[model samples]
Target: MENQFSLAHLTVIDSPPPEMTYLAARAGYDFVSFRPIYMGLPGESNYNLAQNKQMFKDTKSAMKETGMKLLDIELAKIYDGVDPKSYEPAFEVAAELGARHVLSSIWTDDRNYGIERFAEICELAKPFGLTVDLEFVPIASVVDLAGAMDVLRTAKQENSGLMIDVHHFHRSGDKAEDLLNVPRDWFNYLHLCDAPVEIPSSKEEMTRILREERSYLGEGGIDVAGVVDRIPNVPYSIELPNIKKTQELGYEEFARRCLQTAKDYLNRQVKT
Candidate 1:
């Protein structure tokens, strides 16, 4: 089967949705991921398509022109005091863009609260035919496969699934072999990227690396092939965010290389 690749918003986050969509299509990707739901992080631009009508229209125009589909929308964070209903507008926009998955993560250590909030998100997304994929980030509360799996199992939301980002998977110390314990149905897609073999020693350093310096596939120490080999066939969202490289090469050129390197790595994996 041919692998479908997505130009994740983070890969060329500097580009707005319309521009990113065109770039992804021109770079030869089957799909594209967008961050229409604003995370309100420092240095991050708010594309919030739910509220930005002009940007949303332009983005839709690009998608229609390029025939590129929206793979997923991020991120519905399950943190303390978050109202799951707040994501409804984003969910409505996702369905309008034809996206089927909504990415989320556990931000607070309160497991029970996280589970309840995540379940609420799943329910809210259900009307729009979107699945809430719980991604375990090394910097977040659900920092490993076990933590993410436990939430989904306990929540028992049919519209919920687990999202594995290879960089986070390795950083969190979960082995590729550990994927064996997760049910096949829980996997719908993967966030693909590689990082240096040397793990960061502090949360701040780790956060910086994840947001600014992720290595290209096969150029880093991650066993990307090993992890992908264990999961079901699904779209690979290349979320490689290298600030310096993007600055030097520009978003279009960087996005093209990201997709090319991913294909090269996957092809090599097939031959091996």
Candidate 2:
């Protein structure tokens, strides 16, 4: 089967889920990864679809009309003193929308605590048929491939796996060789994007670039082909978030370019 592409919400962060669904369809995406679970980050909107009944209905309507599937829902973070049960509502909403995965990350530096919380998250998402994918963020406590693998191993949950975001992997100084031995089942999907080869010196600089200005595939410094070749051939969720380009090109156009660049880049890989 051909690889499916998902229009990740971060690519069009300003658009609500309902509108994002339609936009994804128009932009030729097979699915969408939404941020229904609010994280309250700066410039981030709270899209609490769990409580917003009308918005939920609208989102469902859009999904039905566009035939767009909910690939996943994000930010089910494993943090200090966090209650995994608290995300039950978002899990319910994601299940209702037919999402197959739940995105999570480790925030606390305590390894045992991270494992416990991540396992709890997996258990909570189990009944909903959601697989929790642990992403390693550079600024977060789980800062590399080893840390992410450790959490999954200790969590020991069937419903848990790892999510490799190319940007984060590169930022963490992890190489494509590092992924070769990882179990294929651990990779449910990938966060596809590119960034400048130069590593930022400060965590704050990295955060700024990650949230506001990721490059399109092949346009930046990442050895995307090498990285992609190591992982499972699963859906690629386009998570390119460029604030300036979005402002200049508008959401629809920016989204189209995101998809196009991705397709072109992947095609080149095939030809080579």
Candidate 3:
């Protein structure tokens, strides 16, 4: 089950239902990521935490019917200056939902404090036996691969490491040499998404590009297959934010297409 592929919360964050498990299952996904219904990123629309308990309740119920477990709890929407004590509730949520990992990226002004913060978080998550997956996003303050590794190393937490998303992987300026640099065991989870050749100028533009122009792995400009071939095997999840495309097609169709393409690509790599 560690090799399981899953759907990211962003795919269906807007209209999460108790039946979301069914959608992921029918789409052939192995798990569903938690975006936490009410939490939003800075300057974005915010959903009050009042709805989190209900959404958590709904997600738990849905998993019972569909058998699609919650893969991870996303901390993407919660950025810097979060109350250190406030995360207690999130860990509690992850534990309740059978989530193994809590994922998030932090900003850089407090880079010196990241290791300490990570150590504290790891200790908190450790009591629940839940680990943390850190992703480096350009928009985030700690925006580089080196910065991420440094944080992990300084924190010295075995329970916390990186989750590589292809979009972030390439954009972070990781070279093939970068692939060789990553500690195999450190990449605990991964995401596969694609964008066309155009380089996005800003975070908002990047989101728009991914949402509008990205295609399934083999169809896009990203050397995803190459990257996958090089990295040590880990759980890879499809995280296309093609909301614009979904307006024309349904989730299941797009998911099936993406998964099949990914599976086919990986299968071929295996054969070779």
Model-by-model lDDT, in order? 0.93, 0.93, 0.70
Against the true structure, candidate 1 reaches a TM-score of: 0.98
Q: Write the candidate numbers in order of decreasing lDDT.
A: 1, 2, 3
The TM-score values for the models, in the order shown, are: 0.98, 0.98, 0.87
- Candidate 2 lowest-lDDT run of ten: 263-272
lDDT of 3 by residue, 159-244 (tens): 88787777776777776457678788887678887776556778898766654556676677776766776677766778876766
**Per-residue lDDT of candidate 1, residues 129-209 (tens digit):** 999999999999999999998999999999999999999999999999899889999998999999998889999999999
lDDT comparison, 1 vs 3, better candidate: 1
Q: Residues 1-272, candidate 2, lDDT per residue (tens digit)?
A: 57799999899998999999999999999999999888888778889899898999999999999999999999898888998888999999999999999999999988898899899899999999999999999999999999899888887899998999999999999999999978899999999999999999998999989989999999999988888888878899999999999999999999999999999999887333
Model 2 misplaced stretches (Cα beyond 4 Å) = 270-272
Prediction-by-prediction clash tally: 0, 0, 1
